[model samples]
Target: MARIRANGVELEYETMGNPGDPAVLLIMGFAFQMTRWPEAFRRSLAEAGFHVIWFDNRDIGLSAEMGGLATYTLNDLAADAAGLLDALGIARAHIVGMSMGGMIAQLIALDHPRKVDKLVAMMTSSGAPNLPPPTQEALAALTAMPMQRTPEAIADIAVKAQHAIGSAPNLRNSAEVIRQNAIDDFRRSDRPFGVIRQFTAIQAQPRWHERLGSITRPTLVLHGADDPLVRPAAGEDIARRIPGARFKAFPGWGHDLADAMSETLANEITAFLKA
Candidate 1:
């Protein structure tokens, strides 16, 4: 792990594979740390001959926090991503983002086109008003306040949320694995307020469908067919708006990226970047 000054904040980041290799920058979703990009998944990408970069976005993980701030937007987040690349001396990289990260990735390709070689927007929407909203259960799980901040309590809530929006019954992880991940994540950082701030940023972001057309980079849109959080229609709409962009959907997948889906996700991502 290392720290770099980006977008007026210190960002925590890690890199895998040889620096000489092509770079793949992985951005996580709302309130999620870079660690959410699974180790095994990162390894697979590295083995595929790419340098994988993972980092904690501002206000999350060991990165700087925005205390007492009222609001921020996705453009600010996009700038941060660009700033990180600048700090690391990477001229350009394949930008891969999940959920909110996808929104930021879209903005990066629009705002900093030269810095993004290829784009992968996964399990996210274009933030258009016409896009379908998340299901009640998924929304509730996302917005529900935790009863306690204890590791176990947070873990329980996390597990419940995962079940509410994760892969179909047969493709989900064992309870033990989910519990462990929750505990680990909680221990790393439990700042619910920061998460709320990130949520605020997402809410404040403008719809990107109008701007997406300007993204001329090779683009790939990935989503779960049954994702309750960000519906499949959102993914389709994104692909439809971006010229020459390809869309891929997993039949039974959901908002959560469990171990069961890692191989398929990594393989598809590798092929897209290579092509």
Candidate 2:
């Protein structure tokens, strides 16, 4: 783990693979720490001949947290990403972001075009009003009250939440796996307050549908057809708006990226970046 001062805040980040390889910057979703990127996933990308970089965004994990109300917009987050790249001495990188991170990636392409090479936006939206919203089950799971702060309680809640919004039953992520992941995540850091602030930041951002078309980078949009959180329509809409972008959907996947889908995602992204 390493820390660097970027965008006036200290961001905790880690790198994998050789520094001389092509760089891939991974931006995780809302309220998720850099660990959400998964060690195996990062290793896969590194093995594919890329230097993978995963970092904690502001107010999450080891990154600097905001002291007051969540006033920062998505653009601020995008600037933070750009600043991180500058601090790392990386001229440009393959920008990959999921959910809210995807929004930030789009903004990075729009607000700092030269800082991004290829763009991969996953399980996200363009924030267009007409897009389908989260399913009732997904909403219920998302809004469920936090469990007790104990590791066991947190792990149980995490498993339940994942089961609610995860891949179809046929998928391979067992409850044990989800529970262990939750335990590890909790052991790393438990800051539900930071999650609220991140959510607030998302709510405060403006719709970016009109601005997405302006992004000229080679882009790939991936979404789960069964995703209850961000519907497939969002990915389709984004792909339609971004000229020359490619869209792919996985049939059995949901809002959560289960272990079963990791290899497929890694291969797809690796191929896209290589192209």
Candidate 3:
């Protein structure tokens, strides 16, 4: 584990495999830490012969949270990615992101094309700012009040969070793990409002539909057929907008990529890179 001053904020990052291998940077979704990428899964990617780097975004994990209300734009976040690459002495690397991370990836591909070797955008959207905004139910879940984890509340919170975000069909863990992780991660920092504001900023960005054509790199778009948070429609629209982008979605999958489909995700991503 290490902290690197990036794009103005200190970012926490961890790596797997040798630096001599091809580099693969994995960015997590909104308000999530890099731990969302499981060790075993990261190992698989590393074993596939790529150096894998996973890191915490601004307000998550051990990274510096320059106060939740300071505000940040997608351009700012993209610059952070670029700064990270610069700090690591990497000119370019395979970039993969989930959900909001995908949004950042899109911006990076558009603004810093020279810094990315390939792009894999999973479970994300263009956020045309106006078109098909997240379902009210989805928004509600994202903005819902956080419930403290008590012996009695664990099951309920787990169910609600799972219901709102769970799309994994092949998950091996029970409800306990989900509850524990959620509670722990949510409390890692003191600012849930920061997440909300970032979501709002994303919502307020100019529609990304128009510029998807400019992203010419080999790109892979993955979505869960069962994703409830950002519907699969977003993925479809993205694939259509980008030139020669391959799209895939799995059934019984939801917003959280950590669950059942991670293996398939790793497989598809690795295969696409090789192809």
Candidate 4:
């Protein structure tokens, strides 16, 4: 676990593959640790001849905390990512983000275009008004908090949430895998207040949907047809608003990355970046 000071905070990060290879920076979603990025997915990208980097966003995992402050916005989050590249001496990189991370990635492409080679937004939204809202089940699952901070309690909440927003039964990871992931995350860092702070930051961010048209980077918008959280139309809206952006939606997929979808997602992303 490498921790480096970037932007204004210390970020826990890890890198894979040769340093000489083209870089791919993976930004995870709201309140998710970098470990949530599957090892197989990271390894696949590295094996495909790219240097992959992922880190715990500020206020999550082993990264620096912001106390009770919710003053930061998505743009600040975007800067954190760019600063990470600077710390690593990377001039530019292929930026891939999931959910809220996608929103931040869009900002990077818009506000720091020189630092992004290509952009991939997955299972995320443009925060456009009147966009389809999450289903009741997904909404409840996402908003639910573990009553106790114990690993079992936290893992149970995560398991239930995954079941609600994850891929179809046949396409999802085994129950054990999901539960263990949650447990691991909890054990690594159980900062519920930090999670709340991150959520508040998202709520405080200014809407940037209309700004999507300004992005000029080669972009790919990937989503799941069954995604109930952000919804497929939200992803489509991003692709539609961004000139020349390509969109792809997978059937039987949902909000979370499952083992069954890893290969397809990796292949799609690798092809786009190489192109």
Per-residue C-alpha lDDT of model 1 across residues 1-275, encoded as one tens digit per residue: 99999878799999999999999999889988888887778999999999999899888998888887657898999999999999999999999999999999999999999999999999999888988899999999888777778888887888889899888977777678888888998898877888989998988887778888878999999999999999999998889999999998999999987888888999999999999
The per-candidate count of clashes, in order, stands at 0, 0, 2, 0
Worst 10 residues of 4 by lDDT: 65-74
> How big is the positional error of residue 20 in model 4, measured in Å on the Cα after superposition?
0.5
Q: Across residues 1-275, which tens digit of lDDT does each residue of candidate 2 receive?
A: 99999999899999999999999999988887898886767889999999999899998998988866657888889999999999999999999999999999999999999999999999999889999889888888776755578888887887878888888987747899888888888888877888878888888888788988899999999999889889999999999999999999999889876877888999999999998
Writing each residue's lDDT as its tens digit, candidate 3 over 1-275 gives 99999877899898899999989989888867777787767888999999999898776678877575577677777888888988999889999989999999988999999999999999999766544556666667666664753534544555566666776536534567676766666555445656666676576666667999999999999988877788888988889889999899887777875555667888889999888
Report how far off residue 143 is in candidate 1 (Å).
0.9
lDDT for each of the candidates?
0.90, 0.89, 0.79, 0.93
Stretches of candidate 3 off by over 4 Å are: 129-133, 147-158, 168-173
Runs of candidate 4 with Cα error greater than 4 angstroms are: none
- Kindly list the per-residue Cα lDDT of model 4 for residues 177-237, writing each as its tens digit: 9989999988889878888888887998899999999999999999999999989999999
Model 2 compared with the native: what TM-score? 0.97
RMSD of each: 0.9, 1.2, 2.3, 0.8
lDDT score, candidate 3: 0.79
Pairs that clash in candidate 3: 167-253, 167-254
Task: Give the number of the best model, judged by TM-score.
Answer: 4
